[model samples]
Target: MVSKALIQEISQLEADFCSALSDPTRLLIIYSLADKPHNVTELTNELDIIQPTISRHLKTLRDRGLVYTVRNGSSITYHLGDKRLTQALDLLRAVMRDRLKHRASLAKETKATINA
Candidate 1:
């Protein structure tokens, strides 16, 4: 039920947009935005990152279309463009957890065989 063209399009979007998520700080920003919107100052203070770093991360997120902003008075609040992004991240985390457990089990088996 999947088409090659659709896959190509999705692949391009992933390359262009998801690249921003490759940074740990950006991932943290996404997770943090899931709870509530935050301005640059709040994010910098909460994440213990410098102001310039947070601003740079936010710029990347905005460029990637992963985040957006709302102007309020003299401040801007950054929001996740979609809630499903967090769900996708959670699914990836679960997959990673399973892979880790599988690797641990294999290591244990190997150790037992070596000791035998």
Candidate 2:
């Protein structure tokens, strides 16, 4: 029931989403914003990244629809727009943990073979 144009649009959006997450700084920004809203200054202090860098990454997340901002007087607080983002990050972390465990097992087996 999907038209070619719709499929193309979905593909483009997927690519954009992946591109948005391609940077480690952006991923960290997403993770930080997942818990609560924060302004650039707070994010900079918590992430230990420079203000400009935090702003740049936040802009990328905003563009990708992963975050939204609320203006309170002079401070603009950024919050996660979708909770699914945190779920996705959690799944990724689980996969990474599994991979690490597998690698450790392989390393142990290799060491045993070497010693044998």
In order, candidate lDDTs are: 0.93, 0.91
TM-score of each: 0.88, 0.88
Backbone collision tally, model 1: 0
The C-alpha local distance difference test score for the whole of candidate 2 amounts to 0.91
| Cα shift from native, residue 24, model 1 (Å) | 0.5
lDDT of 1 at 111: 100
Clashes of 2: 0
- The digit string of per-residue lDDT tens for model 1 on 1-116 reads 99999999999988888788789999999999999999988999999999999999999999878899999888899999999899989999999999999999999999999999
Residue 6 Cα positional deviation in candidate 2, in Å, after optimal superposition: 5.8
The digit string of per-residue lDDT tens for model 2 on 1-116 reads 99999999999989998899889998888888887888989999999999989998888889888899999889999999999888988998899999999999999999999999
For model 1, name the residue pairs that clash.
Answer: none
Candidate 1 residue 78 Cα shift, in angstroms, is 0.4
